[model samples]
Target chain A: MTEGFDRIVAAVAGMEEAARSFSDECRIVFLRNITIEGIDTLLTRNLYAERIRPIVQFGGYGTMVQDVLAADGAAGSDADLIVLALSVDELDASYGSPGWTSHAASAQLEGLFELLASRTRATIAVHSFIGPLWSEQGLIVAAEDRDLTSQTAALNRLVVEAVRRHSPRFVLMDWERYLRRLGAESALDPRGHYLWRAPFKRAFLEVWAQQLARVVCALRGRAKKVLVLDCDNTLWGGVIGEDGLDGIQLDRHQYPGRAFFDFQTTIRQLAARGVLIALCSKNNEAEALDVIDHHPACQLRRADLAAWRINWNDKASNLSALAAELNLGLDSFVFVDDSALECELIRQLLPQVTVMQVPRKLHELPPLLLRDGLFDTLSVTGEDSRRTRLYQDQRQREQLRSAVHSIEDYLRSLETVARIHRADNGEVPRIAQLTQKTNQFNLTTRRYSEQDIRAFIADEDVEVFSLTARDRFDSLGLVGVLVVFIEGTEARVDSFLLSCRALGRRLELAMIARCLAKLREQRGIEISRAEYLPTARNAQVADFWPSVGFSVTGTADGGTRYMRLIDGHAGGTPTFVTIEDD
Target chain B: MTTPAIEGRFFRILSSLLQVPLEQLGHDTSRKSCQAWDSLKHMHLVLALEEEFGIEFDDAEIADLNSAAALLDAVSRKVSA
Candidate 1:
């Protein structure tokens, strides 16, 4: 069994490389197949029962489709998702028939889909194999005797194409291809099968596990709302610390340092694409700020960042203080450190933080951070390009952060600008990413992917909108998202969340104001209703409903529901903010 | 494509799977003295040898597979058959 599995492991390693390449274009997680046929069939059965059963215990698998030889339904309740590894004898007779597509087929597939979908807790069996990734869209796949790789890719394309066509909420891995890619060595592997379910590489598995964590995050609206970056050695090389001004490399150049500089440029551009970039570096503040201020090839400066945190302090404390000052979650932040020891220290102290180790080899930094879709983006919005500059503009909002120490006075000052736009097909992807990530100020705090967002929008009662805020210092890139369900004057707030960066500025009030305005203008209502459910993070918003003039209502399911009637509507930003109409 | 090379490869696979002493696995040595040469080993050796040689073995040949010479004769007949 060990030697067999060794072969299986080697084969899986080779296929794992292919899996990476295909998943880049399409989402084919893995392909695994094993046949246990030998003279000692009874012995093989015992091995399957004792050894294999436990391995697939948490995996999603279907029952052998006796005649069709396909894995068709959930193997059992614990088996959330799966495709069966069936032999020719398992193939069912009605497979190519018409009656099978009737109500029976409906009930059959539905039961299977439900078996796995309910395990959305685990939701497995996203794919199967016959020839390859796409031999026939209808069935899992027909196992081809040869040309395994080509067949696997084809099946993968089929699954993706099917997903695109039906728009069903499915995330699947391809096993046949995954196995062949794993090869004969892995095929014969006897590590028990549990290891096969893991990614090709153990190091890569950490990233995959992180992705699962992200899925949980987006599910809970706990996505990092902003990324606070540092200038000098952090963003570019040479620093102003010792490199003095011009010595710093900012653009593409010679080996080593040039790559670090290029990565910094990529970071600046990523910020523009709507990753809230804030400069948080410890320096003379002025001397260090000068490199950004006076560099000839500098792609970013005070004008490009949403905010700047330049002061002398231990970076771990600085990052923690940065989170508190911004009112963002510690879990939602990714801190990059050029110093290995610093990164390690931060990793030890603040494990939740995604501390990216700036490779000692400078050039490798950019590609390392960018690949595997670290900042997996499904869509980029029109509001993104203006992000860096908006942060610079937002400085005006922050100086105001102190100008009116009182929250109300802060709201009253600096004429506020907020532009609310209904998200359409073009904006769905970003909207979904936001809905998946935004918490804190979030009302209902429901997370959705681009695909899920589109499906949710199909319901008539739900209305979704994104908020773009610009204050004296910055035009915070689409910092707020609002999801509301309505029945006449009673508007149930399904999900309302704002980027924490936009918190000290009272953008939540702006989002609510917009909601009220939409109710009156779009829905033709003079009255509006809302709710506030207490969450661990959004306790600040526990009183948000009452503060917004919402009347106390009864609590059910241990959740406080609020109601309010706006006689006349004014959905707009505060005095300090000026909404940029998209 | 040549028959001789294929048959040689067949004998080589049989020798390994059956654990028959290579020197004694000649054309006439029956399955009598080979300690590993049992009915079950016979089938396993046949399956693996068939895979390596690309020839099918019948029940008679499978039964008659006592010595290397007998195995060769049975395999050649199947190859021709």
Candidate 2:
């Protein structure tokens, strides 16, 4: 559905008055060739509700090259994001010309990227140009390879290539896809281009701004991690309890049944990309498990889910229980159901969880689930695809916990091995992901991007270490990251975090003690310093540094500063765990 | 739609976009009288009107229809036609 422009303007007007009170600011610079005025208002309207203020600045008209290449001018050096929006008609000299070619256009884009890759630390978003609505060559242009459409296609290929070449820094905005969705006729306004060179219609601009806001949310690591679903009509066409398993409508080959089949398939694919699948249904536990494990048309199995609650309990309670079982915050959940009452109750009780009610039309189910991109993450790593298995492995560990008598005996029987090593360039994304997503066990709570992690890996004075652990049951992929900055004889722990899957194994102590030992032996670091910056979710780590034999030096504003003399301290890895380092 | 209905919708959009009160907008109101109706706001106002009414105005009409009376006259003509 399209948003009213007046509503956006009114919302932005209200946000501008209270902008200073927002806790976080996402500074975005739009380096565009055309007039892009109202998008900032739309972006503010999108991000303000989440307590993030977006400060949208602009480069001068047709000054993209000058802005990108500037060393200290009004480019994006201090900005969190830089968006390159191009108007091919204005920037290209060969547009609609007889001797038109994509050479100059591609070269210009490459030049901008080269400058941006070296000069700017902000995340770059480049727009993909679309074909014009009306071609100069008329109907003959439809079949010709030398037409403007073809040339623009060639240039888009170059854009894709450039994004690939400078990945994790540059992202494609996919304007051409949005154009195709809106259709060229409704997307562009020729009169506006003629009047002020603002090419896109207001509707198209709103959609484009929404897309960009989605990218901003993903980059800020605000993507939902869990998808909790109701079972009755949400996953199948009928209730599994009332209607027999044979009576329920879920067939991959039929009409209405195919829709639910496709919806399950989409949820499974989301699970493959690190979103934990969970069930919060009021059904007979045995029946639901039977449907999941034995139903021929079901795309998901019982093993795909990380946790579930198939009881008669209220949905709000079930959702909270699922979050606790998974050791995730309620804010990381996205709940979906076919019952309006259930959805409304969860929305009222757990406002942090995003709730989606199924649309009335059955065929619209899959698109509605994916319409807003609630589960979109910036990049998928190897740890992401194996996340569901990691949770299932946690279930096994819980079973093992109950089997053993003493805590030390339990940890020793598991035969845990932790490999703490200096991180290579390939582990930058996973390390950054841990820094962003790990909350309860994180010290200092400093979030970094892949670019920042890459820089730390390459810096001579900084050491970035990754920790991967394996027990008798399964291997937990890169589950911890420790960033240490060395200055003279002092080593400061800039960031230390462990994933929830790697928690409760006494591995954090092993990780830190091993790294501190290496820092003293190889890097000649005598005094080690770390801080416990308290956050809303990280109270569990308040006394962690003290437990590791670091004495408190000062306390201010509820934050504790810690320092330790590494030479005299007897910090050792836990006897139950073995640690290997590079 | 009746003229009063169109007038009511038009004034609501105009007041919201220009940040002007509905009571102050009248037939005699023009760009010279409204301090908030600058060139950029004028273009936005036109675009919003076109989108809301599901009609397009001529380029010359966009420039000439600066007064409330003239805008009403042109919109009425388009809607009725």
Candidate 3:
């Protein structure tokens, strides 16, 4: 009877299960990268529209690209596929004829680089991995090979290129991978309804939904809201105030103490990965700071933490303070503490916070840390990289404060030479990232992918102004993106986002003023409209238009949209950006 | 003397990631590993092998590792059972 049940399970498990078994059997299957012939189906209206339906329906896909024919026949330009699994309501908001739209979920400026990469010469490959199709009644999954050698690759690339180039938002979930995954899952479940798949032999729909989730991740970027770190037992063995600096155990000698030193180093590495590390200690701050500095075994420095409310403050409060200083929600942070008391406290106070309890032992730290790292991996985008050096530049700029009298004089003193260029294929990724992350100065706050930004430029009516400002504070790097959408010679400043690292220097005002004038002259537009989409983080720009000499149109729905007509060059603010290198 | 099949077990494990399964795994397969053996997979390979043999390799060893044969030879030293 058991053998019969096993046979029945295998039979009913369907192709999805078969696929999993295939993976387990070959269990050794390698990722086969086959290039493509060309991207044609992506540009095909039927399939492009078809794939978008499920994403708009099931995934929280607010924006998507439809059909696009590449202006340039470029090679080596790849596609980042997205699978959209949306609810039924969100579907119609996208999948509309022509332009695309979606509700603002996730951080606006978060996936800018991915957006930009998906646009321009890049392809915004969209696939319907989940949700019910327009006429069909099941999940939709589309993803495939995108290299030039294989048919699947060619098909996906073509769609990706089209999606990347044509629309501001796109879903990228190829069907091929979904089917394989579905097959695998089904083979394992034998019941097809579970994660593996069932009811259908092939179970392509499940693949579609799962693939859409993957694509959404690529688009939204991982929300790395917090960096949880262990104290006392983890950072330095024994309590800080209790054990004292010399007394505390770290990496080097007895027990697994050295691993703590390595553990700190790993935390520092996470910081580089853009995870904001925080301290949850049952120790004194001054003493811990001393340990961070004086301890030869210490891997993380005091400056590495964005915020630490070290004291007898319950770890919940410490985690809260860290969240506030980092300007992130408590729900966004992952809290790691060795003490069960602290972890439990944070768990109670900020239930949303990801609190990890370290084992009483030290050797278990690395594996636990590594697994957590996977959970919070923020599929790094181009703009993500700007944080470490950008913050470093900001800190260095802050040091030169007393040296300058007024902010304007400071701007002038920095010998700030900004190179403003039209958004090309190469610069779109950086521009998209800026558009996603720069909230304090972002005007419209319309988050875009590299693919969307590329398409934005290809529209003669749309102008994207990419600015790279290097002041005497430091080369803030390619720090700003200004997008202007024009309609019948009337232009609307769609988005103006600048890095927070470059804030407080009046660069946003100066750059926007300059770009608007430039776009006005180049496009010969009469009026340029800009809006202040009030986000919790973007209040700084709430009065930006009024401050910069643009008339506010009206305040409606709690957002202020404004416009101005510039017949001549919008004057450049002779700003000083002092370069302070690390 | 060990069974040649031991090496086959190593290659078959690699085949899941390397794409070149048991049939193609030769001793001279060399460090040019396989087309599928990209950097990301190299990381996963290290992780899987660690789980398989309950051993850990530093980043230094990761950089040193390349071919299936080289990995197996290294694993042979680390594994007891």
- Candidate 3: chain B TM-score against the reference chain B: 0.75
> What are the per-residue Cα lDDT tens digits for candidate 1 across A1-582?
122222222333334333433311211111123322121222222222212211122112223332122244224333322332321112333433322222333344445445444443333334443332233334443344223334334445655554444333454434444445445343333221222211122222223333333332333344454666666666777777677655776656565556766776777666756776666676766555556655666666666566666777777788787677666676777777677777787888988787777667665787665543345443356776675565456567667655544455435443357777776667787777777776677777777888876765776777877787665335667777777777776677777788787777767766777667767766866656666767788787888777777887788766787777765645444555555545
Candidate 2 TM-score to native = 0.68
Candidate 3 Cα outliers beyond 4 Å, as residue runs? A1-222, A252-255, A360-363, A369-582, B1-81
Candidate 1 chain A TM is: 0.42
By TM-score, the candidates rank as 2, 1, 3
Query: All models, DockQ values?
Result: 0.03, 0.34, 0.02
Residue-level lDDT tens digits of model 3 in A79-197: 33322222212333233322222222122212432444445343233442232223221243323421112322333455556555545454445554454544544422223222111
* Candidate 1 docking DockQ: 0.03
**lDDT to native, each model:** 0.55, 0.84, 0.54
Is 1 or 2 the stronger prediction by TM-score?
2
Question: Model 2 over residues A545-577: C-alpha lDDT tens digits?
Answer: 989989999986678899999974547678989
For model 3, what TM-score does chain A reach? 0.36
**Cα RMSD (Å) per model?**
23.6, 23.1, 28.8
Which number leads on TM-score? Answer: 2
Query: Which ten-residue region of model 2 chain A has the weakest summed lDDT?
Result: A401-410
